[model samples]
Target: MTTTDMLTGALAAAARGWHVFPLLPSTKRPARPNHRERDCTGTDPRCRAGHTGWDARATTDQTRIRRAWSSNNPSYGIGIACGPSGLVVVDLDTHKPGTEIPEPWNRFGIRTGEDVLDHLAGARGGTITPTYTVRTPSGGTHLYYTAPEGVRYGNTAGTIGWLVDTRAHGGYVVAPPTTIGSSSYVVTDDRPAAPLPLFLLDLLKPQRHTTSAAAPKRFDARTDRVPAYVASAIKGEVAKVTSAGAKQHNHRLLCAAIALGQLVAGGVLDERTAYDALTDAARVLMARGCDCTPIEVDRTIRSGFHIGSRNPRTPGTTRDNSRKAA
Candidate 1:
């Protein structure tokens, strides 16, 4: 994407009062490096000034966005800080070729993140309240809603369901028209964001501590969404495995396996696809001088993946922690 294209999209969001920042060129990772407090060398350029993270540094000023992403600088992608934007975005996602929705969701034939949200909304005796929305490149959606005044909701991971997530306080989202490879996030609905409905707002609140998993306070059985963002991650991780040094060969492959496992649990990628990809990468790495054999690699992947499935995850997406699933 061109700097001009990014600038225009950033301006559009900022004009709507959504604070924006620079993501890395073609990535969701922030362009603004997060300075570590422990390494605050006070004099180092990266840490010389008081540390200002992406969320804190995000702005609504058109000039700031333009200057940061102009021709003189990298043609950075756009990130909208959800909290500052006063938005609570329901991130509905699709699944990868090799993943399946978990437990209860799968039992109900629920596949996408959108389906989960819709099912819950129906259970709550309500319909989805449409607002400003962004559609991610992988067929997922970002349903933007106005946050309630004075409530700071943080990011969540599968707390809503198998593939659904939310982005709020302490989180950011890749804004529309930000390209990654050939695809880009684009605005599907440019209308003003609707105020978050009470039902959903309540879901984002502190859920009561319970002995057992509790059904969300106001959910029904009408969910209709899914999630899928593993395309680049798989390719990247596999590439890493194939290029890893001897000291990190097995470790890198294991890590990649575990990461893919988390996505499998999150319904973002299928188990078989994740396994085969890792196995193939491992075999290639082995052929390239690493001593690891196919059997050993398979076992390593399985072990790491088992550990990861317990905790579902999202990658480079706006993750919201709504109430935990029952």
Candidate 2:
């Protein structure tokens, strides 16, 4: 399609109140450089060099949208910023040519986007509610939903499992009619974006400890060793969360929660202690450029703590030392 056609689609999305931005011509990547070193803070001469910090660059103003598209690369693709657009897109990635199934999906026996969708549907008591679906240029799928109010969700990869990623706050997705090479993103389902389902919401919510009074007391026998163990566990989970990449924000938070939860279950730490330690670990990852928020860390820990409390670990049993912790 011509640049005019692509711009028209972008304007349509903007008309619907979705924030739009121009992507690099015919590419899914943003038209900006996101590196902190190259990041532009405001409208300076350097800022005009490239579109940096696209989350801030996304706009709904028709004049800005037109200017972006009418630039030298008028054929630029359309990118819809998720949070500003009130969108939460579930991106089910397909296996790229010559690449094996990603580790997360293979571990879960998921082979395709449809498989993940089916699993979600089954978990929700069958019959997944249909929403506006987009067929991506690379044979993947984008399932769009209206994000929940008062809850800001950022992009996440592998949090929902392998081959599944989310585009939310601080993220963007290629809009329909965008093309890369011979492939193009097309609207498969013409339905409007639907509200996120409850099951998905539960999965997405941050975990946090609510009751300090009910927190488990530290065990006397292993009191000295408890601090060391807790430190070790937190460090280990932090490493995992960090190594997983920014897209795995939720996944990383969940991993930290489970790790700290294990420590709480082992009586090495109380719920309050575990919550603080987990939060610190999450912060460490965030400082290193992970997309984690304090709220997300709290919620993840709370959720994991419940599970750990229910299945307290037996005393004297040690976790696998073979596994490297940080």
Candidate 3:
């Protein structure tokens, strides 16, 4: 298959549940610390003082990762993850043909799997280097060095940053700017690199951790009981309420609920309790007044549904009365 065709196939596979991130551009986010101090117990100095830190053993999620430019709070940023170890952080910003390797520990290159190995061999005085490759959602490949034992590779943000040290870590991600052709492969000289064995591939496939506290059940958005935007907001909000605290967690959801609730409060589901709950929530958020879009949020008092308990308005079904009331 052609490169675009291969990408489409990968995206189709991703849609079936493999998370995919289109290499799209995002606005520059107001810069935050490359790292945050956290208080896991909620009683530590950082936790009480509102500091943040990432736990090495903490589960890494594709949807909950965030980067410098994400709008979603504590956005689950995109990266190439392998068998419990995070490879390189993918830079979605630059799309040029050549690869951009990080400095001091300059390891990544434009070469393919086969060629990268040779380059590393020359650099390391002909020492044999082992390599592993992963197929990206865009049908590109991520090359890694199987570091010798006792070597360590990690960044300050734990699961977030793309920084890799050559002697310290056994593996590194192929930087984003690097592009591999349909027939070209990569080579590395760090160690002896080879194709992944089936046993390792089986382990590398993404699987939700059984130990993850079962995600709280969420109301179905596909049922068309809620307006599309409101349903989207609810799905987004549910993930918000339960999320472990991160940079972008609360403000957007708070704003979304306010906007949607105000829009749909006076219609068929109009009740003082639901209306008051939403209004109060909005007011609290507005008090803090972080920047967010003014979208309406409506919720059913009894059922956890956004619009109402039963079959409610679908995307195109906003009732005239509801609009008038809004």
Give the RMSD in angstroms, all C-alphas superposed, for model 1: 21.6
Candidate 3: tens digits of C-alpha lDDT, residues 1-326: 23333243323323323222322222111112223344145454335545443222122333333222244433222222222342322211212247555432245543333333333333321211124333443444444433223323442221121221121122223322223333222322222233221112222234311111222233455535545565564555444433414444344344333333333332322223223334344334334542322233222211122323122333455433322222
Candidate 2 off by > 4 Å:
32-52, 97-109, 124-127, 206-326
Error of 1 at 289 (Å): 84
Q: Each candidate: what lDDT?
A: 0.72, 0.67, 0.31
Report the C-alpha displacement of residue 261, candidate 1, in angstroms: 41
lDDT at residue 72 of model 1 (Cα atoms): 88
Candidate 1, number of clashes: 33
TM-score on alpha carbons, each prediction: 0.61, 0.57, 0.23
Q: Per-residue alpha-carbon lDDT of model 1 for 42-88, expressed as tens digits?
A: 66454556766788789988777879878888788999999989988
Q: Which consecutive 10 residues in model 1 have the weakest lDDT in total?
A: 208-217
Q: Whose lDDT is greatest here?
A: 1
Q: Rate residue 208 of model 1 by lDDT.
A: 20
By TM-score, the better pick of 2 and 3 is 2
Runs with alpha carbons beyond 4 Å of true place in candidate 3 = 1-50, 54-77, 80-117, 122-131, 135-141, 145-149, 154-326
